[model samples]
Target chain A: MTEGLSEAGLIAVVCEACGAPRTPIGPGDDAALVIAPPRGRQVVTTDALVEGVPLVEGVHFLRAHPPEALGWKALAVNLSDVAAMGARPSAFVLSAAVPEGLPAAWWGAFARGLAACARAAGAALVGGDTVRSPGPLVLNITAWGWTEGDAVLRRDGGRAGDALMVRGNIGRSTLGLLNWLKLAESGWGVDGAVRDDALAAHLRPAPPLDAGPWALAHGASAGMDLSDGLATDLPRLAAACGLVLEVELAALPVDPVCAGLTPDERAAGGEDYGLAVLVPAEHVGAFIARGFASLGAARQPVGGERPGVLWRRHGAPTELAASAFAHFSGG
Target chain B: MTEGLSEAGLIAVVCEACGAPRTPIGPGDDAALVIAPPRGRQVVTTDALVEGVPLVEGVHFLRAHPPEALGWKALAVNLSDVAAMGARPSAFVLSAAVPEGLPAAWWGAFARGLAACARAAGAALVGGDTVRSPGPLVLNITAWGWTEGDAVLRRDGGRAGDALMVRGNIGRSTLGLLNWLKLAESGWGVDGAVRDDALAAHLRPAPPLDAGPWALAHGASAGMDLSDGLATDLPRLAAACGLVLEVELAALPVDPVCAGLTPDERAAGGEDYGLAVLVPAEHVGAFIARGFASLGAARQPVGGERPGVLWRRHGAPTELAASAFAHFSGG
Candidate 1:
């Protein structure tokens, strides 16, 4: 669909699909002009999605899934990072390297999806660049947000005795991915409401956008978005804070579709885009009341124990395989 | 070279190569935090490069050129846009997709080049994401800069009587690209100092970083960096300002190596990364004293002359091919 379209034409398609720019300056100039955030600090993050690389696990993202869904996922993933910083998204820029075979309609649909996400996050698609690639389709989004004063959240703020909590449904995206891979159990059924729910989770993750700022305002100690699942991400938080995060498998707020899955499967499967947070013991009650489920607590590493996640089951220390998906690890 | 390295290890390699980030929070966090511009507005832009698509021409950026050169070119091109806006670059975020076959050493060298540019631009490499791709290498850089109040150079600010001027050498990158392709005429020689100069222009474009801000301060009406050559870009400025730009081919500040090329070749060959600026008539003397070369003047359209560039030579109107390499236009 993009056979004879000039680069400018493609850019126009994107700008039109994205509607008007919310900033003082928008696309079509040497650069976009935007109002600087008040409080003199801004949050920035970048993320990318590539064809043939599983958006979890499948070939369908490019070949079957709606191009709009792919677009939503690309922008949403970056938004999750901004949300983790407890910032309000202001604007975003995208660089898409697309193959010649991709229809112009597909590109427009993709832009619409991206625009939808930007609107939902209160961000404007301020600028971007489009180039033709002989390789697989690639989408990279860089998002910027702003926070008030020093109120932004940080991952290293947790301390021993802080309650570790999880918000949003854990393992939901993984369950959706498993369903796409046709690995669901018999009782789970191939086509059902649960499968649909799981599919939605995988395709368009709605990261809890308000949670980070809400938690920060209410005195949460530390937080990070859970993109890599508990087995992998919890330890990162623990290491950052120099404490051991001890969590019980039974307390995990697993997605309803993943009810029959094992604790390990639910804990290790990733791409949930949920918030794994730590709150002072004094604020745990307020945290839970705001919809965060307490997983366990941060503890001081004793004796030769290292600063990392300490898996527990029914009050007993447990050993669990903790391999999470890694890009270069060839997982 | 990255055989057994985990994702975190690869990220660490980049962080180390780039050295300490010049931001409050960088690389290791959910999102980097940067100080906002004092003027309450920012300039933002993005640009991308892909393998197999000519970095002007040839496969060397991945298969032959020093990975560092590729790194420098990627970021430099983006910085060119920020420079066009008369803004001081603050920080940048990069999203890089690497193939498994790319050596870890190559990635390290690439990071060094990127870091060098970041330091030179007075900006920091605050954050990025690295993901493995089964396709050609892709790099996208999003840069941010700050301006004092609304003191930005917009292409539309040119007046009908503004003097058209250019900063830096024109057709230099294209000459360098031609040298790399071994298409330089025999009289131009294959490996002399001129060739080296041209090659450097193509590989590590040193954009006129101070010109935009200086022009704005000196009452220049409008400005933009010439990435796609004046044949394509001048008309954009003219269109934005609702006027016709009349220019003399003899007035272009062509590179020494391009002495033998046709006027059109020198005019239309893209990627010069120079500034095509319009200064008010009152400031033309000062603009020239500051090292800008005057081309001609912006004029109100006469006899239905369209709002675009009007090529002239030896005091007479002339026609030009004006094909400035549009992506997907198949050149």
Candidate 2:
């Protein structure tokens, strides 16, 4: 991290910790080589995490947050996107720009975290870049994978009459995020088990990796990750399939942390790295047989009779309003 | 550039400019898909550029430098690595963190420039990440390529008794960078067409794309781009091959403007982007006959006689001291 330290020296220090022999060509060559499936296409996505964007101090995490958490979340978000496409993640390339005088130990911790998470998620670090900047640290990750089976799930691949389903409880991450922010401001002691669960959900989102491959094999019509909240993202899925998405509020696998929130408010909460998927009625048995996790099979599709998002509460349908996490909409 | 612009809206605007159907899958969904070669390894490398490093104000260019130039150079430097590997550049992903209030028009221009350069280099912009940073703009590119033939050119593939040759003029880019920096500081009027030429050389350098493939076919044992200058880079090449690199002063393809500079100084000016290669003695005739554009065959390599850079001037050889444009060794 010193001014006199060379890039090669920094690379050496980081690579020492990041070494896992994940790929035939990893980090030191002109570029890393990833073997593409001889038959299937590669699914890829990129995401950039800027300081103070989605992670405001009172809303996301404190300034004293660990680099390990940062490293995990940076890759987790992009991996969630790949999971949305129903592709098993293969490898990724990471790039970070950090300010000078940051301790070498910080990079060591980050590299360790990144390598550990990648390995845990069945992914590998094939390539990366690091440089000093006169700016806040920024991390960007590009992840790619191939389909587990023949079909590579697309966001627009669903049809009318598809059953609406989701994996994992909705709005948990949002509840966790809010709690973390509040606690950071209050300096309050823990709220026992419930708050801790919420905090974990917010701090380290576990993208539904198994559900993606399962959807592809079990006949998922269309699917996408709930990143910018269900209300914001589900409509897009409905719009992509030219159908009106009708969500039964009672069917949502609502978490204990979101006990008091209205159904619509829970639907609007962000950071749930879960999938909102469409499955056909005929394959409904197959989908459930494959053990598709949370949010369960309580919801039914509106058969694309109309185009938009509709929430079903007590058999009454209402239009869902527009909403998303305004990461870049603030000054 | 406005504070209230949504990330989606900004992405739409940027994608509009960057879209040209360059790849089968271009910048959407989870990720951009680049078809991998069914055989052969994929060459990859990443580079991150900060605002001030290697290009200081009143040293490299004016504050109002063209966005197109910046975009071109960001990819150009990465493409240089691909070129060094004797691989045809197939795809690349770019990520940038821009400060708030950076005009959308600037993005349009930058995207246009990046697309144009990628097209010119036979590469495609497969994916990218864009976000608002509470800091200066930082650009990072990860580029990968696949080889034309069986041989994958590596920096450490050569032998002690190989011949040393170069692909193009070494000092032009260095001269160009210096002139542009001097002019940026002085605000002096143009020195005819040559100054403009130098500025262009520094701003948008065109690495010899064909030279890499030619080297691979003509039996180049070892090769790498002349990045980080000849003095610093050549020693590394020598160290990689376990031999002393001997460069005849007269054999160096230096620019006329660098006539008065010391050989070591000329060797230290970075960013030439040409290739310094080691060729076997048997393939020397085929190397020149195959039409390598810049540097011709002029000398033979000493068989690991010493272990460093050896420069010959007036029929006398001496060791070149360590010198390079160090971005990290600061005041």
Candidate 3:
């Protein structure tokens, strides 16, 4: 016989796996708390995912996307925001709605994934509510964190002469989604390693957890994560900082996997999960020496005070109309 | 052209109506705070409402039930929980999903109602999220409050011989639901005053906010609000306290409308929103003389210790069967 557990049962199962006791007041309490840094400020943000937008079954992820990955993704995306602010995540509250009769194992995996992510992010699952829903599953997570000092970064601080740098290689998740779509449409099997990495990238896109602090310590003028894509995010960063961003097309860094794709395909695809920031010219060399050694990359400028993103193809600089990312264009 | 506002627009509109200053750290921030009591404990609770469960369009309130009322109800129910703990509500966070194209006017009214309710309750709308859904709207609200000294009350503190007491009349919301149902079914219009009260009871159910602090101040043992009706909430209170709660049928303060209902209708219906508490026998008179008189009525012993709730009707005592309000079996 299958175990017939309710929402409360699922919560208990996951809470057991997530053993960190950061919350003096945990689940079952009205609210949970994480210790605040004595001198720093606390940051909080919330995001909601509905079934149709941003999350569609059999499209965004598999219809059977590991429940744990679902849970992890839900919290991880919010944590990225905290990381962007150069804060260490401390607590999170989740509110979820699931259709009745969802399997207990599904919830177990979901909770396990959530717990694992929370532990990895140095956060505690504080408190949340669960209820039955008549539609597709919905998860809304609220994350809180604190930073010690006035080192928190915002997108509005970039300067005209600052160098634009990104923490990691981009376009992996977009490629993964493309691969998945190709597989689903053509019924062709890919190599195990390739499929695994692609799916992992889509399911658990890595956000640079240490990048926020690294940038703060090294004097990054302004920064944000490239959840939308460099093309879209850079414009936002530029707008926030009240400057025009110029890019040298010849210096554009494209993933090896992306090299094989059509330029358009490589331009507008979303979900890169890379960190982008502006560093003043004076700090750029020091950042390259200390930060690049840590992140395993040489700090490279992708853009400057130009009007738009420019990319070099075949050794010639060319303006790229847009980068790979989805825009909220009132669909 | 119609106002094509984004999700952010809706939030700004509501926040403006609330007249609560947008926190230096507001909704877009990771979390929000109001000045919590420095020396006292914070009270907290959460409640969720699903479309088909606690509410059905046109059945529960009206198809035209103002959006503001829905927002108010979302916060109010959780506020009732804080009040049950004898705490003054300070802040609330709301999460909601509504069908796309839900009228802007509806949203405006909803925000107005939410603002009014928050102001009246002395609570601030600290943060919330709104999303578009494909199904009926769902609202989940979390409320936090604070209490001074050793004044907070809990459900586990009642002794076996303590006198069970309730503040305010019960079964009004339930009657209101029934009356609305009758009006809908019979095609009969309700009188203005009756309609107004019934709708008010359904839309803006009065919670015993003051009674919570009063009961705690005057030495009430265990306390909880009657959201699940007296029949259901009382039993849980009894179980939590590990005592048999024998409610004297004669002392059950039924509303005048409830008094007119059939016994079965009154018994199975829920939504009283009154405070049910246990007071020690010694302090019962004091509570009655001070707290109860100032509030509404005096405390009356309803029943004696046995195993479960026993009700006396027509001078004969019998086990009261589990009411419909106890949605789960084996209560």
| Window of ten residues with lowest summed lDDT in model 3 chain B | B293-302
* Per-residue alpha-carbon lDDT of candidate 3 for residues B1-331, written as tens digits (9 for 90 to 100): 1145567777877788877555434553324533434455556566656565324221223434446666677677778877887778877767766666667776777778778778889887767777766655666676667776545677767786678877754656666665565566765364322345655676677686888878888888778777766666766776666676655555555456566654544445566667877887777788666534211122323466344465656557765555543421211
Residue-level lDDT tens digits of model 3 in A171-232: 56666666665565655354322346655665666687788767877798777766766656
Model 1 lDDT tens row, A1-331: 2665667777787788778563238888889998775563688999877787444432224435566767778888898888788887788888887777777777777778777877788888888988877778878889988876666778888999999998977877777776765643333233212237777787777889888778878888888988888887899899888999988988887566778567777788778888888999899889889999999999999999899988899889986644433321221
Judging by TM-score against the true structure, name the best candidate: 1
TM-score of each model, paired residue for residue? 0.91, 0.87, 0.77
Q: Which candidate would rank higher by lDDT, 2 or 3? A: 2
lDDT of the candidates, in the order given: 0.77, 0.67, 0.63
- Total backbone clashes of model 3? 21
Per-residue lDDT for B211-269 in model 1, tens only?
A: 88888788988899898887778888898888999999888764567775666777777
Instruction: Give the candidate number with the greatest lDDT.
Output: 1
Error of model 2, residue A129, in angstroms: 1.7
lDDT of 1 at B159: 86
Better of 1 and 3 by lDDT: 1
RMSD of 1: 4.1
Clashes of each: 0, 7, 21
Give residue A179's lDDT in candidate 1 (0 to 100): 70
